[model samples]
Target: MKKLLAALVCSLPLVSALAVDVYDRDPDHTFAFFEFNHLGFSTQRERFDKVDATVTLDLENQVGSVEVSIDVRSISTGSSMFNQILLSDTFFDVEKFPVVTFKSTKLNFGKLDDVVSVEGELTIKGITHPLTLTVTQFKCAMHPMLRKSACGLNATGKLRRSEFNLGRFAPLISDQITLLVSMEALKR
Candidate 1:
């Protein structure tokens, strides 16, 4: 009985260590950017200014769940002309579809701490498709200034613009869009 009691006592710390932590995205640090081949020339890069996400990380199970939303109207390109173009019916059609969202279904760890494959549904322009974002660098640590537990992730993926019904200049322009993302979240 004493031996069993001691084992139970020691397991308390393990349980505490595996406690899941939920976090809210830090808008100031989270950005979803993308690059696409333009006219067989230089790659054009753009990003959404407004992004929100919630992350629930289960350290014990080595899994996580995340929901990310992006405001289509907040899309930014280097040039105002291009930005407006993207918001028009030819592209994002922000007037009709104002937002894009991703809800994670599963997280596959390459290594518990190094990389993870996040499989999810990406909805845009009224279309939902399966997508995967490979998170390459992930860390959870205490912030130096805020002193709060914070986590950051670097992930990338690619999608075919045609799949989302944004294929305006298809044959001429590239259909593949590269997604670049950086996210910082604070424990909530």
Candidate 2:
């Protein structure tokens, strides 16, 4: 009985340490930016200010999961009028659809160092599409400033705006939009 009790106590820490909680979205360290071609002349850039997410990370297995949501009305393009036009009926229609979301289903750790591929569902304008994100870097460690475990990930993906019914400025603005996502999550 004494030996069994000792063994159980020794293994308890390992079990607790292996489990990871999904973290809250850290706005300070998170960024969602997108770029599109402007009449084949220059690349137009924009960013969303409000973002929320829940992330689960498994460092040992090299697999991580995330669900991110963004407010369409918060999009900023450096021009108030243009931003308002984007939120109007022809574009995002923020009044009818308030949120755009992405939910991950599978995470594949690639052979390359710290490289991962995530496949998920992206919902925008009431349309759901399967999207894959190629993750370049992923890291988790104790934050020196916050004194809590934190994780960071960077990913890039491209989606056609027309697929989600965002086909307002078709030829004027390129159909393909490049999305860049960078997020840092703190353990809850």
Error of 1 at 115 (Å): 4.4
- Separately for all candidates shown, the number of backbone clashes (residues 3 or more apart, or on different chains) is 0, 0
The parts of candidate 2 lying over 4 Å away from their true place are 1-18, 111-115
- lDDT winner among the candidates? 1
Clashing residue pairs in candidate 2 are none
- lDDT for 93 (candidate 1): 93
lDDT, residue 98, candidate 2:
92
Candidate-wise lDDT, in order: 0.89, 0.86
Which RMSD does model 2 reach against the true structure?
3.2
| Model 2 poorest ten-residue lDDT run | 109-118
